[model samples]
Target: MKITIAYIEEPPFGWTGRDQAAMGADIELADVVLRAIGVSTIHHHLTSFDELLPGIQEGRWDMNVPLFVTPERAQRVAFSVPVWSIGDGFLLHCGNPKVLTSYEAVAARSDARLGIIAGQVQFESAKSAGVLDRQIVLFKDQPDAISALRAGMIDAYASTAVGNRVLAESADNAALEAVAHNNGGDGRVPIGAFSFNKSNHDLIKAVNKRLIEYLGSADHRARMERYGLTHTEIDGAIISQSAKY
Candidate 1:
């Protein structure tokens, strides 16, 4: 009858607002879906990105805010149907003097350094694109990475294209900008969904049922739009989920 969800301070997805209440697209989505599934009470626990999976597996929370679904992660937790599909991008100082548009571009320049949150998929993406270990800097969270980018410690900060855009706009500084990755031939975007302890089959099933009926609804789209998500992201998830499930 009650569910506690873990979330990180990732804007446009989840964050603690001015009022100290959890807010963002993913938090709202979780609230709506969980409530509809008959959860009488809901709790939001703020945690670091690295802690989300282990915390859930330890029974510290019942669910997590949407995160990218990876094969390795699927082995540890059960994910709800995809909620959004998004591509990666970079947060850079305004003017982008280094011309860093993609991971490959950064790799090509020995002087270019990229910042990524520790444990994020971006690290692997950067490595696969030939970025050397010395060219990469890892941070514990988004704020730290953004700080490094602003301070000239890192040439670019890699994260979701949508999240970087929102962060750039909210920064209220003319010195920050976001550039979508040039996926080139691949053109594939990663999909994200709520994750739960693998053993909690009943909870996952109920939430997935409600999520299926709610994800692409008019109300859902409108709510998400307030948090900077568009049909491009929302509809993509619906389409991807349809094919997979």
Candidate 2:
């Protein structure tokens, strides 16, 4: 049977429009899973990240690709196994002209605008750090926040380190640079793998079985490396899922 995979333009995670060939680590690895299972798929790139789940709910798509499943989201949708993991990152102007790294630095510079997804962990970190509300501008997606930063509407964008690297290195994002604060895995900032549904229990099991086979393989490691997702401070498949929601 042919499965329709609903994906976004999120780089390294589910890149399609980024390259003419629709190539990405997730896509590449997913190809292996589909081929092994004799399952055919037609990739449908959604207009926006917000559309990912809605499409699934609407029955317009059967799969959501490379999505990070937080505990809260798991309630609304059935997630398949997480395709991979990521670390939080800070995207700043070149040279980090502000020399900003941690939340403390951001809070100290009241003049600087901190861009973050409203309900994301980054915003929670800023909140916990005592960063004032005015200093934080909520965004719908990582790319939007990055665009705002480039446009000078905001001073910095916070997201998974993987996103920071993708945005900073994207030919379109020449002015930005990724700042890795060594925060991943630490108690301060924790991230984890993507999530899929128990709703598709069979599919999830099949994916997990395939993933298990790929675990120590060179190809699996190489594909992930290409996505800029090096070793991360990710929480467990189930535990971190609970906290982020």
Give the best candidate by TM-score.
Answer: 1
lDDT tens readout by residue for model 2, 1-245: 67666555567666555355566666676667766766776564554666766666666766666655566767767755444455566889999888778787888998978998755667777888788999999987766887789888988887777778876887888878998656645544443333443356666667667755664366766666777755442223334434433
Give me the displacement of residue 103 in model 1, in angstroms: 0.3
Instruction: Kindly list the per-residue Cα lDDT of model 1 for residues 76-138, writing each as its tens digit.
Output: 989999999999999998889999999999999999999999999999999999999999999
lDDT (CA) per prediction: 0.93, 0.66
Quote model 2's TM-score.
0.80
Cα TM-score per model? 0.98, 0.80
